[model samples]
Target: MSEVLTTDMDRDALNNDGFRLSVISSTAVLLEQFSAVYDNYPSYLEIFSPIKCQCGKLPVNNYPESLQKQIQRLVNNITEGMETQRKPLVMQKKKPPPLKMFEPKIEEVFDDRKKRKGGSKEINEKQKLVHKYKKEMKGAIREIRKDSYMIAQVQFQEQQEKYASFFLLTLTVLLLLSMGYKIKWL
Candidate 1:
């Protein structure tokens, strides 16, 4: 900015004081320009047209090349410095704590065991009922089998008596015919 002011066609001496004054003036000009452009970047882009400075020169067009270079250097320095300042993030994966270590040996264990045993008393009674039903069903099946065997034996004896009676009737008729033939009663 200081270089920009001393760089005016009318300004001959470019001393430190002249440079300081020019910088101050350039700052004021820069503020105005920023405010105008700060409304929007597109608005700033519009102001890229020749900006006139108080030195009777267009500020943007007549801006000293050295000052533009200095501005570029300042921007690069700031960005690089900020990059160095950022700390590297190390992500740490946390593992869950070992699952509830070891079961406690307490009186509750004995109490639960006794309670479970007491409940099983009812289960024993139900089991007894199941056993009794099984025994009764087995006895009924045995009685049915014995009655079936007795009925079959009676039926077999009846069939044998019928066949014997038929054989005896046939024998008596043959004996009568033989006696008639011997008496010549043909």
Candidate 2:
């Protein structure tokens, strides 16, 4: 879905200061042609520029003495400017608060196992009592649910019988009215 823009087609579409960009297949040919036309074109393009090393220093030995100094100065200026632009890491030391210590007043009174041995019997009895109550409550709940279901069924049957009786009475009345004076009923 990308739109292709050609210099010929977009010549009048763009403003006067617009740049017409085209892909050059032969960069060496293009450079050579430009060099022949303009003698200082390579200086402006910096074709023989020195590459910066991993340590931020440029390889200036291949360049001339004047260019080596210029490159060194440029690298220094760049590093200085970067350092000035960056915020320095200010490390502040923090001291932790001291721990608190205290001494206990009371000493060992009696062995806890003896007390627990007597209390365990009472706890078992309480647990049995709670279990017995829970079983009885579950039985009572089941009985109550059964009784409620039976009551609901009885009420439903009574409603059905009432509806059937009302329907029969209405049918008999309608039949008698439709018969006019042709029927003889007591």
In order, the Cα lDDT scores of the candidates are 0.58, 0.55
What is candidate 1's CA lDDT for residue 81? 34
**Which regions of candidate 2 fall more than 4 Å away from where they truly are?**
1-119, 181-186
TM-score, one value per model: 0.30, 0.33
For candidate 2, lDDT tens digit of each residue in 1-186? Answer: 125555655655553322211111133235334434543332422432232232145344644575555545544533333333334567657766668769678888888854443557789788778879999999999999999999999999999999999999879878888988454568
Candidate 1, 1-186: lDDT as tens digits: 666666565355554455755784566456454544453433332343233223224243445666555444433433333333334577768976788879877773345633343547779788778779999999999999999999999999999999899989778777977788433434
Local distance difference test, candidate 1: 0.58
State the TM-score for model 2.
0.33
- Best model number under lDDT: 1
Clashing pairs in 2: none
Deviation from native of the Cα of residue 107 in model 1, angstroms = 35
